[model samples]
Target: MFRLFGFDVRVQSGFVVFMVLIVALYGSEFGWWLAGAIAVLTLLHELGHAFAARSAGADAEISLGFLAGYASYRPTRPISRARQAWISFAGPFVHISVSVAVLLAMGVNPLSRDSFDDSPASFAIWWAGPAIGLMNLIPVLPLDGGHIVNTALDRVLPGRADKPMIYFSIAATAGGAIWMFLNGYQGFGIFIAFLIIAQLQLLNATKPRPSPASPWELAGRALDADKPAKARRLLTAALSHPQPIPPTSNLSMTPARANELIDLLPDPYPHGDAGNEYVLANLLMMTGRFDAAAHYAAGSFDRHPNTLSATIVARAAAALGDHSTAIGWLRSGADAGTSDSGLAMTIDRAPELTGVRHHPDVIAIRRSLATPG
Candidate 1:
């Protein structure tokens, strides 16, 4: 059990204890007033998401977490890519707005000061808000900025958002670690190392386990050789019973490139191919074909019930005005160990769906997803 915004909130044991420790040690030094101010800022950051989601006619819930706080919301209907982008950016936007407001207020006050050495309380007010805002903006998994990047990448690249996001996270984390080391911040460096290790573990776990050539890949190879009948047979097999590819000969291309090649096939399976299905669904969703995207996502899940397919299905369901369905699928995938931090972060931000949000599996999967891949 946790408390925030004068509300009793339930959070995972890990985060609940972490927040408790933070409050215990720092609460006195910062003073109750300053500590409460920090809490309010965190809540407001989440509320930014809540308000934006509400504006889109979505349902949202705000909650406290281990070290921070979040809002969970699912849109009542499919929204435009632009709208999605806005929603993704809204949390940070709120944080920044609050920071700006504080700065403006400070500027207007004759006695307002910025030096932490002078008064820890004033320093807490001045820096805590912006620091929290900036931290949320970090483009790492489970962060608001990470969501912005992932959604944008989905919009731009369609079939492959994971690789870029993972790669970017690695680079950013590594760089942060290096900066901390160089600055002689041993404690911070250790913390960053832990974060890196966590992220890496997540990356390895969520990585598509190596498998034999998927039917889609076989179909692509056949199409490349102009073997139409063989291609059709493979596509049929994929549609009928999509199994994890068995370990086989290495493909010359990266998975993303292979997926692109598969997408180029003249008579590709409409929804059975996971990669193609994801791309198609996102395209449809982007174009406001919520029903069509939902259909394709269902087909994708039927073929391969992994993180990507689950996300598509959930998003599609949300677009189709079925928040319950969306939450169900999201929770199911999370339970099945589909640890995609971006997906978990999405769930973390929407808490009104308490059954799903409070499920122990949800945080486990999310933590797994955030581990570096």
Candidate 2:
């Protein structure tokens, strides 16, 4: 792996193996040049996407593997549909442009070439770019063109685009395979037939998927496997995720054990999310860290001011004998729940709030929550 234009480029074993196979099959020096040319062009193709993704505020890693290359990117934030389409188009755009330029410089007019009149090198290079690039523009899933089409479909139909794209890809692949076979391109036809089967699998897979587990979940697994050190590392990593989406609750470990693992960490903990703060606040409360729990809960409430955060803050404050603080938080929670039908103030019945449940201000907030709208 190396860095180019600020993006990491990883040449996988499969990439090298495939290129080596090409050389062995041809049994000549020309095969070496041909493989080298394809690798360069494919790198350039993936670079287009990497650069485009960078411009869109994403970090992209280009991985050259079997068959072709892929640019996997993680956007700093949600990318707009139009930007996604443009990013998908970028790879093929660079591919076609560079291929045409090379062909023209080699004294072969790509636009005028209906048949292959050029040398094997030019023919192979052309196929790598203009031909494959154009093919990639076809609206099929897992391909550049397919992604572009999927983005457009999503823009127009919202969340209802995946099934349509998969269905269309199946139809297109099936039809293209038939056309290839009819035109005496048996190899390409067979490839397209395989694509049809892949698309059918994709069609069947168009359903809701659970969110991937966060580092916290992994930490619990590490502990379960009797790897306390690994659990500690994962727990720390979870706190420092650039963009964390922690699970609603951890089932991997009990609150007491999780808190103990966290306490083992070295000081000056990593920056974290409100999700982490709220969850940690509860864990702190469970482990009898009332003051620390109040601090974390209050910090979370101040950042996002959600009912959940407010409830935790109130509970912590009540446990700490700060009834005034508890009452203030309960009021804020109730006020913020106007849209949720007083969900915030409905916490009067919570067992954790029993210490301050009879406080006048707390009771008033609960009365409002209990009032018929």
Candidate 3:
């Protein structure tokens, strides 16, 4: 891959075979010049998508493969339907535009074609130009038209657009194949029919996942698979819901095991929802990363003050030798009538707090917890 216009542009290994096949089939009619033109124009078609995607603040890459090319894009954040539509349409739009411009210039200056009036340039132009433009407009998944249709339907159906897009594509593909057969393009018609059937099979295979997975199911599956980071992400997302599903109470998971799963999350964890922040704080604390744990706990506490979050901040503070801050957090929790004996016990046994366990403030905290709420 090589960078072009701040985007990676690469041609797949199979593209060499594609060029060889094209040369073998049409080299006599259009000669080597026409073959080179097809390759260049196809690259330009993919570049159109890259250009439009970048214009919309997305990281874009262009790739040319056997028989086709595509532009891959990843936006920094969610993009609007209008921008998506533009990006999807740009490739065909550029292909057709370039073809028309070249055709028009040739028409005005007949001398431009004096060298080879009988060359296959005309045939190559039609095939690589308008033909390719029309083929990509077919409404199928992984195609530009499919993207356009899906985005447009999102505004109308909101969340249930997949079924409609699949149905419409099937109908369109069937009609297109029939028209091709009737027009004596039997070979192309059969190819289109086969493509349509494959797409339909894929739709059937993935029909069950009509929407995103539920947080509990995803989290549970992650835990089962021993992917603690993924589970942590889902749990955090669950907690962010307007009415979060209580992980401990709503799910059939044991609290001890769940906490242990949280401890398995790797260090430098990706920051996420408040609940995940609290979990990360606990993980860091367990790993003897007192400073980072205190930072995360404090941030989580600032966002959503709760008994658990307060205890984390307090425990992390105590581990870091901040006796006053640690005692103050427990005092605040007690003042709010939110003290938990489990939290006090956990803090009292923390190995990092051994140095300050006999401090005056620590003694008072122990006395205060012993006195009860």
> CA RMSD for every model?
20.6, 8.3, 11.6
Ranking by TM-score: 2, 3, 1
Better of 1 and 3 by lDDT: 3
Residue 363 local lDDT, model 2:
60
TM-score of each: 0.48, 0.61, 0.54
Query: Which candidate model has the greater lDDT, 1 or 2?
Result: 2
Which candidate should be chosen as best, given TM-score against the real structure?
2
Residue ranges of candidate 2 with Cα displaced over 4 Å: 28-30, 112-116, 197-201, 209-347, 351-355, 360-373
User: Please, what are the lDDT tens digits per residue for candidate 3 over residues 1-373?
Assistant: 8888888988798887878876786557574555676788888888899899888989999888876687999998788899989999999899877875775565622225452244467556756676667777776755678878898998999988877777777777778778887898886854585568766885796567554444555776887898878877665555454434333312344555555555544554445465446555665666667787777777666767666677767777877778788778766655544545755664577666676667786677667675343
lDDT of 1: 0.64
Residue-wise C-alpha lDDT for candidate 1, range 1-373, written one tens digit per residue: 5444433444556554654565686767665535666666776777777777777877777776656676777778876767666776788788767865775565523134534325555566655566667776777866677777788888878968867787788888888888878888776654476557756875787677754565656766887788868876665555444346432223344545454544543443444445545655555555555676677777777767766567667766776667778767776666556556647656666333344555565555555565442
Q: Candidate 1: lDDT of 5?
A: 41
RMSD of candidate 3 to the truth, in angstroms, is 11.6
lDDT of 1 at 105: 67
lDDT of 2 at 197: 66
Residues 1-373, candidate 2, lDDT per residue (tens digit)?
9999888999999999989987897877567767887788899999999999988989999999877699999999888988998899999999999988888888887765553345777777777768888987887977888999899888889999999888888877878777888988896754575577667778778866887876667777777798889877876666555444655644456767768666856664444666666666767777878887787777767766777777777787878888788888777777767323434333535566777777777666766764553
lDDT of 2 at 369: 69
